[model samples]
Target: MAILIYTQNYDGKFKKSVFELVTYGAAVAKELGTEVTAVTTGKLDTETLKELGKYGAEKIITITNEELNDFSAQAYAYAIEQVAKKINADLIIFGNNPYGRAIAPRLSVKLNAGLAAGVTALPSSVSPFTVKKRVFSGKAFADVVIKSETKIITLNQNSYKVEENPVDISTEEFTAEIPEGAYAVKPIETVKSSGKMSVTDAEILVSGGRGLKGPENWGMIEEMAEILGAGTSCSRPVSDLDWRPHEEHVGQTGKVVAPNLYIAIGISGAIQHLAGVNGSKVMVVINTDPEAPFFEAADYGIIGDAFEVVPKLNEAFKKFKAEN
Candidate 1:
């Protein structure tokens, strides 16, 4: 039995989350007395694929079929299933992101494997294969065991730490049978961001909410994000009001994030909102109201107006970045 990790590439580069998954899968492989293999589909440079070795991937399988260029839930699942079967992977790992969400469940059903998504920790015990996972939109944690002979896990981003265990990785090309009508629905347009970190992959996140008053006042927040090299996000109300895109929204009804540092500006810590971000390693809440619930969950709190406080914070951050 081998541990197979499905690595994803966006705009020709592997995101940090992929390496984290590889590291976690490598640890699992070690415990099972097996090796980790990484499988990826897309057009990527050989050098980029070899980097998985540092994360303990012994071999990297590249599926270079043109049909696999763009993401299709059914097609991708079938392709990965083929590789999983060839390698006899008893344990499969995926990122708990949009791409993984689209394909993991399909692959799980195809392989008849018990699946555990949004996993936050490695298996506490391998014999029973119990793992901790987030429940109720990250508000709670539950330990689950997969009684199936094969298990598939979709890891929550930032939950696992990435460590380098460099090895000489071998690469080979593999082909899979693509089901008919798999790519029936093709994207009409694909807009890719240039040199911007996605909120999901960002280490530090600078999030704003209705407290900003208006979307026009986002300059300070954007400036602060630029200075800190962080990603920008918004509260649910901001998205509901169309002040920001829905993708930027983070809450119980939106994306769940666990960045290393999450800075909330003008956002009241509602239970729904808190449920999404409570997994953050460190949280800083800046709000005018001292009674804001965000402060209760924050490692640091600033009871002040965001308009005045944010500009000052941006200046301070700029100076600190320059001096340090």
Candidate 2:
């Protein structure tokens, strides 16, 4: 049996999360004494598909069905099931993103596989297959075991580090017979964000909260993000006041993130907000109040006014980058 990874590409380019899955899956493949094969839906450039080779995928399978293009969860699940069965994949892997989250559960039920979502670590022991994952919105960790004959896992982003080991890759096209009425719901329209890093995809993020006082003063935060090449986000109160879009909000009630580095300016870290972003590798909190709860969760804390501290930090970052 082989290990199968579901690789996703948007606009012909793969996200960083895909490589994480490949890296994680490749390690599992080595443990199981098998080669890893990747299955993706959509037409991508040969070179772009070959990039998976660096992460240890030996074969790439492309599902070239036009009906599968629109991303109906049911249809995509059926397509992936066929590929997995055809290749006799015992271990199936996905990134814990919107696309993977939507389809992984469905695929699990379809395949009758025990599913472990938001997995954060490699299998501690592969004989019985135990994996570690975040629980309670990043507040705690739990070890999960998959008992089914076929196992499914959706890995959390930034959990696995990519290590390149290049090999010759081969690509094959498969046309799956999607059952009747799989694509029942069709999306009417899709709006794409341009030129800015999405919070979920960003490696670094600079976020603000009510501490900033007003949306008008967000320029300093934006300037800092620009200098650091980071994404911008907000706390729940800031979004509630419409200082920022709800899409930029991070908390228990908002989007969750696990960037490599997260800088919080003017945000008082409530348990809810910390629940969302505590997965970040490094966190820096900037607040004038020395006793703000945010300091408890931050790896580094700065006690100062954001307005005074942000600009200076931005200039320092610029100089550091210029000198390096």
lDDT computed for candidate 2: 0.91
**Each prediction's TM-score against the native?**
0.96, 0.98
Q: Report the C-alpha lDDT of model 1 over 1-324, residue by residue, as the tens digit.
A: 789999998767887899999999989888889999999987778889888998899999988888887779999998999999999999999999998999999998999999999999889999898999998877689999999998999999999999998989999899889978899878788876654677787889999999999999998988999999999989999999999878788888888889999999999999999988899999999999999989999999999999889999999999999999
lDDT by residue for model 2 (213-277), tens: 99999999998888888999999999999989888998889989999999999998999999999
Error of 1 at 71 (Å): 1.7
Clashing pairs in 1: none
Q: Candidate 2, which ten residues in sequence have the lowest lDDT sum? A: 190-199
Model 2, stretches more than 4 Å misplaced?
none
Off by over 4 Å in 1: 193-195
Best by the TM-score measure: 2
Displacement of residue 57 (Cα, Å) in model 1 is: 0.3
